[model samples]
Target: MRVEEIMSTPVVVTREDTLVKHARDLITRKDVNAVPVLREDGEIAGIISVSDLAATHFDDKKVNDIMTKMVHVVLRNNRVVDAAAVMVKHNVHHLVVMEEGKVIGIVSSLDILKTMVD
Candidate 1:
């Protein structure tokens, strides 16, 4: 299977300037673990995960203040195993799936494990 074949699309995303509280609410309401951070140019800037929000005692921050600066990206057409390898190599839990330079989906470690099990 390809990354796109199993990746979750319509992923929850947040702006870099978005308030941390709002981002946190969205993530909580959506019941998602991570939200991809986007820049004004519509490019991925970073990623804000549940851990990022929980790491700080202050809630009055912005996405840019807490987001993981480095994001691992996988091509939509990449093999699932290749994407999993990227995650392992980078020690990341999730990867942004890009198609034509645009983020279209997200693949998590859980997704990979489910694929393997099923």
Candidate 2:
């Protein structure tokens, strides 16, 4: 199995300059636990997750204020085992999936768990 084979699709993203409240709304409405943060040029700047949202209370803050800068990424075609290893090493529940240097999808520990059971 590969990352893309099990990753979540229709990835929702938030711009770095987006307000924290708006980002939270996007996450909530998308019904996802996390979102990839994008730079002005469409590059993956970092990631924003529930944990980040929960850790702050600044209504004026932007996504860039709390998003994790060190994003763990996996190629779309990478092995599931490799992706899992990266998750464990970084202690991250989610990873940004890339294809040809573009954000394509996202894979989380939950996705890996489902793969194991199936």
Candidate 3:
């Protein structure tokens, strides 16, 4: 199967301007481990994960301070196997799914597990 066929769409995302507290709240409310960071034009800017949040270890820093600017992404049409390999190689739980350079969705390790099990 392709990433597009299995990936979750309309992903939960965060804006660059969103505060750390709000980002944390969104993650908790959505019950997701990570959220993709988007720019004003709705482009994929970066990614903010629970690990990234915790790595900051500062109560005062903002999301921008902790979010990873260099994101590892997969094209929506990519093979699920290729995406899985990237995730494993990068040691990342989430990969931003893009289409024409825009954020389309996100694929998490949990999603991959579900694919494997199903």
Compare the candidates by lDDT and give the number of the best one.
2
Say which prediction, candidate 1 or candidate 3, comes out ahead on lDDT: 1
Model 3, 1-118: lDDT tens digits are 8898878778899988788888988999998888999888888778999888777666456677789998999998898899999988988888888887778888888888899899
> What are the runs in model 3 whose C-alpha is more than 4 Å off?
57-60
lDDT for 23 (candidate 2): 92
| Candidate 2 lDDT tens digits, 3-114 | 9899998799989999999998889998999999999999999999999999999958989999999999999989999999999998999999998778999999999999
**Pairs in clash, predicted candidate 1:** none
lDDT of 3: 0.85
Ranking by TM-score: 2, 1, 3
User: Pick by TM-score: which candidate is best?
Assistant: 2
Give the RMSD in angstroms, all C-alphas superposed, for model 3: 1.5
In order, the Cα lDDT scores of the candidates are 0.91, 0.94, 0.85
In candidate 2, stretches whose alpha carbon ends up further than 4 angstroms from where it belongs are none
In order of appearance, the predictions have TM-scores of: 0.96, 0.97, 0.89
